[model samples]
Target chain A: GAGVSQSPRYKVAKRGQDVALRCDPISGHVSLFWYQQALGQGPEFLTYFQNEAQLDKSGLPSDRFFAERPEGSVSTLKIQRTQQEDSAVYLCASSRDGYRGEQYFGPGTRLTVT
Target chain B: AQSVTQLDSQVPVFEEAPVELRCNYSSSVSVYLFWYVQYPNQGLQLLLKYLSGSTLVKGINGFEAEFNKSQTSFHLRKPSVHISDTAEYFCAVILDDKIIFGKGTRLHILP
Candidate 1:
């Protein structure tokens, strides 16, 4: 693809349900990032992956929020026991390198937790 | 910890008029500043970035931003904006290897 791609542009999940969002970064991008954007708020960092290694997960709000990049090219963000607060636009971005590189973002998946 | 503040939630500007979007950041260590623009139903695109050297940085679409270290601000500006320029602009800061964004400012360019 020419740019980063995110799957399930919209997701509606009932409380306690589990949902998974996928992200396909640009070819050979070394850094992948996930962010959660609440309504009327800026996107907040959730986690980052350097290749297949998740180097940062400090921004995950709770234990239920999990992300993985098994092959380093495609990634998934899974939320277990979804809460209302988890309802937001989940954005995925990729960069050429880890240090000070420009990040290219995906269209994002709008998750609605009821 | 680092935080970015975009004072105005929205700004309305007439076409061909100059526009400025203010942004301020707080960080304990050296930081990198960036401006991103998001069109409707689209992902964010980098407008410009302030890394080092000159305080004033020019970007695509005739947009430019100045990094003022003394005031902890990196304000974006365009001499004349077009109707197509209407979009949500976000200011972000890099601190502790993490990028944090502000609430964002919706720029409405009127024809």
Candidate 2:
């Protein structure tokens, strides 16, 4: 694809339910990132991946949140026991490592917890 | 830890008038600054960035920002505004390989 791709542009899940959000980064990109944007707020970093390695996960709000990129091209963010506070837009971006390049963001997945 | 603050939650400007949006950041290490714009129902687009060199950096859409390390500010400015320039603007700072974003400023260009 020409740009980063995110699946399920919108998702609705009940409280306590589990959900998974997927991101397909630009091909050959070495760095991928996930962010969470609340209403009227800017995106907050969630995690980062360098190729297949999960370089950083410090921003994950809690243990309920987990992310992985097995092959380095595609990543998944899984939330166990979704809560109302988890409702937000999940954005995925990819960029090259070692240089200050612009990150390409996807349309984002709007998640709602009932 | 890194943090960015956009002092103005909203800015309203008449078309053709000049506008400025203020942003500040706090970081323990040297930083990279960036501004991103988000239109309705669209993803964010990078407007400009300040990595190093001159204090002033120009970005797309005739927008520019000045980095003031002493004051810890990177304010975005435009000489003229248009209706189409209305969007949500975000300030970001990269610190210790982590990116931190501000709450955002909503720019409303009036006719």
Scored by TM against the true chain B, the candidates give: 0.96, 0.96
Q: After superposition, how far is residue A12 of candidate 1 from its true place, in Å?
A: 0.7
Compute each candidate's TM-score over C-alphas.
Answer: 0.98, 0.96
- What are the lDDT scores of the predictions, listed in order? 0.94, 0.92
For candidate 2, lDDT tens digit of each residue in A32-75? 99999999899999998889899899989999999999998999
* Tens-digit lDDT track of model 1 for B8-72: 99999999999999999996568999999999879999999988899999999999999988899
- Please report, as a value between 0 and 1, the fraction of native contacts recovered by candidate 1: 0.82
Which docking category, incorrect, acceptable, medium or high, applies to candidate 2?
medium
- Model 1 CA deviation exceeding 4 Å by range: none
